[model samples]
Target: MPDIAPQPGVVEALGQIVGARYVIGPGHDQEPYTTDWRGRYHGRAEAVVKPADAEEVAAVVRFCAENGIAVVPQGGNTGMCGAATPSPSGRSVVLRLDRLNRIRWTSRLGDAIAVDAGCILADVQRAAEAVDRLFPLSLGAEGSCQVGGNLSTNAGGTAVLRYGTMRELCLGLEVVLPDGRLLDLMTALRKDSTGYDVKGMFVGAEGTLGIITGAVLKLFPRPRASAVAMAMAEEPEQVLDLLALARTRLGDRLSSFEVMSRRQVEVIAQHMPDVVIPFGLESGWYALVEISDTLAGDALPPMLEAVLGEALEAGLVGDAIVASSEAQAAGLWRIRHSVSESSKAHGYVVSHDSVVPLEKQAEFIRAVEAAIIAAEPSATVVMHGHVGDGNIHVLGILDPARFASAEALRARAAEISLAVDGVLAPLGGAISAEHGIGVSNRERLRRVANPIELELMRHFKAVLDPQGLMNPGKVLPDALPA
Candidate 1:
């Protein structure tokens, strides 16, 4: 750990703002906030302050700004990238929003729900369900990940095929600006011909521009009938064909279309023996298809079955199993949800969250796989993602023994990432689909993004956070030499 020199009275001052019991000084207790969820990035903070509400958060930010201490805003600390982790410089304070968790209200009339930034994603979903509505932003980390973190990353999960990303799911935001001023834009209105979308800027800013304190999120009618199926295919093209077929047959009811490589499913099966894979891993690729309807009936299952039946007859699908019960549907989803945990247990994974055009997805995957193999032959590459939205998550697992050190492994991972980017560039795909450019891809984003785009981002960052105190070293890259 780096020697973190605490500024005189800084800890005491923070303790006063948000009760001494809520303020955790540097040491073992601060470990959880300092280290990222992946354990990839270890950082050091002078103190971790848990603010009770948005006002307390603003006060803490103001104090930090006055003292010239970097403030790293954290929520749940479930981010894959090191966005929430403080820098190892130790010249910073971690502002944790976990204590600010609260569901302010659920407006069925407005079709929206207002929540504190620290509210867990699952809690938000349940709160929406309480009112017979649906909060559709979900992923493996929904149980622990906070709404603010999801908003920061503009997360895209399985349901993105139907509901869209977090950006679209959110209606408005309540942010604490760098200067400690609360900027409230929490509106539930679906239509607003507002000039310059200020809230949208913070949606995917990754806490660079401001700290997201609360949000008004859009809600939808809960699905009364749903069907889930695990379909096997010989190749990526076949999976794409099935996606097209599903869309043509089910239309808006096609909620999720997830693709997983054979290795991805096998890893889940190996690590999570309790989770059952509906179909054996005989095929090269598998897709988890889900269709949902607001109306209650037995029609959903038959509709899903008909789609799969046609695909199977057309040679697009090899074999398929539709979940006959709610328990069965949950079991089928367990396999997809278990992927991240299983992959972590398998080995050091060099993960990529890239999205390509629907037409070029197959080609992009093929070229990227080939490039990865050519770059590192010994690696086991596993692929999966929301195929309906063209987001493909590629994981290259490497043996720890092959690398001499962590630094060596990271270097190799960077090399492989570059190779994947090389393939992605030609396909007109984005380097980052949903995950924002935190520490992991900061430089990569600078290299890949257009000059004008980078310029505009820097301008916005400079205008909002002139001192660069709000979540420093995240999202936007470091300024270039004058």
Candidate 2:
């Protein structure tokens, strides 16, 4: 924690910008912002500031900068890491962007749209659809997560196989600097010849550099026809052939290709009974693929069938089922959606957001799972993720018999993660794929991050937030925001 607490006039100064009623100080009003979505990281803040607009936001930031109060700019508070959660020092201020939720307008051409940072992802998607366009940043938390948090963390969702992550989906952003200056880099331009892509830096910064307020996002023509299928492979190795076939057959139409381990699907079935697995446990590994195209016709179904039929014949896919209708397609997706939920329901699970080379993905999963189970036989290894893009989420579920308390299990999970990440690193993979390096991954980042790269990040942090007041404890080491 920084050597500072809330000054004498800190609360009064913050209240002046957004009103005392919105400035939550102590008691239950500030409780929600103190903890993360998973309840893994519990922290505290001097106050929670809810500003309705950017003007109020600037003022609040200015006040905080003056008072030496750290700012944790939060959007939906739906992040996995403790990036949004305040630290235990009780000296920082939690600045929430929920009040800034607003959909300004969509361009007539439907290529771009202006959205406030606090806009719910689902609302943004709906707004895009109203004009016959598509906001492709789809995630499980779309109904609750906000756009600002998505960009801040540079979230990678199912569509990253085709559309890309939140960083690529967005074109422009409005960020409030640590010094309380509003840098309006908001533009819908696809091409910009600038000295440095400063806007890009803040996209995945996790609020270490500054607070993201709004963004101009790129939109695509809504897919008129969508085809979804769930296919099983005899082995994880065979799934690679399926991926190559998908690219060759579907090309641009191939939107998402997610692979799930048999254990992951089985756990989902055992825990989440409502989320029906369309294709039962007939094979070792399963894949859920989706193809979206602008062309509107019944031909997509046959084309998908032909692709799967060829794979089936080639011995790449064991068995497959293409959804007959939209409802059926959504049903297939429900199974994919239930992986994380079911994994968490059992007990403390150490989740890893990692990616390996496409050629080594299968090998990585097999090796890591073997290593984990060998270490803890009772641990349920839940594995699945966007196999197309190489981003795989591996979870290590703790066995209650082995560990008496959640703390002990969680500590061991971190140790296992390091061992798992070590295997991933040599194979041209990263420990973190989409989830950024917040406080939760600070230690891992310190261990795995390149010495030069980590130094550069430290320099950037110092240059941006010289006083270390903007989200101090995140995306860095030894700079805890108290």
Candidate 3:
């Protein structure tokens, strides 16, 4: 929509591969594809092409490769990082895969399903439910996000404590190489010791290696009974104790153990008034615990209640409430899912998705909060995470009117992030847990990652994409000039 000029014959060549109507030119609505979900990054593209299937996608990539133009593969455009957004130079093509939505096949006996990468994540869950199976890769953005993006980011959601991340959930992948070759490795096998894991390289590559067209994902037996409870504690150590108690009592039945600070709950309640927070914001921290079993009966509720009762008796939990009905359970989860939306609406937020060891999580949070306050005394720090897995999301909210310009705010954010990384490094924590390293953390990764690891990543990128036309300036940092 800006005053950038479109490349000569680029749109026409892409249109020939798909169709003229499918290709969005300079005058069309490219904002949706060019901007990320959080509106943090905006880019310009010579054309946005929507291909119908893998063949058309290959053709488009082939054309882009031949022309030496960058090709950015986008799915649902729900990424937190700027992985899918193209550069502002307007010398790239945005290849959207929304039209490739399809469930190719499903096998309940084999516990696998082959689906097009463009399929909505929730749709895949529903399809698995239809076959009496479960696809447990649940997230807040499942309703609109696509499977391809999830795989690309290696997303870990609320249920990751039980089902693992997308890397563990996926069995195989179908990808289009940078040179336009369709590599079909969509096998629904549980174990295949055949050579190196070529498919694994593309799982979290953020479309830098190639564009994922389809996937064969693993499924599990659907849980027939479940119980949800919210417990309040005076401190994070108490929450960690409660997690240990729940796991000891419930064993593998425990599916999710989410911890949220009082500020996090207040943010949700303030923005989403309709969401019911059963317990008021008086405690220092809260934990949302869920346990499930394959047997359908009332036993699960009593088991959860017993666990909470024990935590209370042990002086670990100050207050607790168990959901009495399905609607009530959904309402509790609604509060958790509303955190991101409400935080964005609250103010300019600087967020981090880092993972620390379970024993170090409490200390990690304390140190990061102190660092944020030291950096900006007025910044309100809110925290939450899947404590069972040690992936915590820390956010610092600031008033937009205080900063003179966006660059000023970004500089402050970068300072805070560096302070956070400093705290995490000593405690043996990672800068990124679920979210992949897009442009947002590309430089951070280079600074924090081992030199040999970065070199190997560059080697792989060079071998797979010799021309460096696939999703340039993402994941790995730009190569230094000779």
Task: Estimate TM-scores for all models.
Answer: 0.98, 0.97, 0.98
lDDT of 1 by residue, 257-326 (tens): 9989998999999888888776778999989999999999999999999999999899998899999899
Please list the residue runs of candidate 2 whose C-alpha ends up more than 4 Å from where it truly belongs after superposition: 1-6
Q: How many Å off is the CA of 354 in candidate 3? A: 0.6
Per-model CA lDDT versus the true structure: 0.90, 0.86, 0.90
Which scores greater on lDDT, model 2 or model 3? Answer: 3
lDDT of residue 258 for candidate 3? 91
Q: Identify the superior model by TM-score, candidate 2 or candidate 3.
A: 3
Clashes of 1: 0
Ten residues in sequence with the least summed lDDT for candidate 1: 473-482
> In what order do the candidates fall by lDDT, top score first?
3, 1, 2
Candidate 1, overall lDDT?
0.90
Evaluation by lDDT, superior candidate among 1 and 3 = 3
What RMSD value applies to candidate 3? 1.5
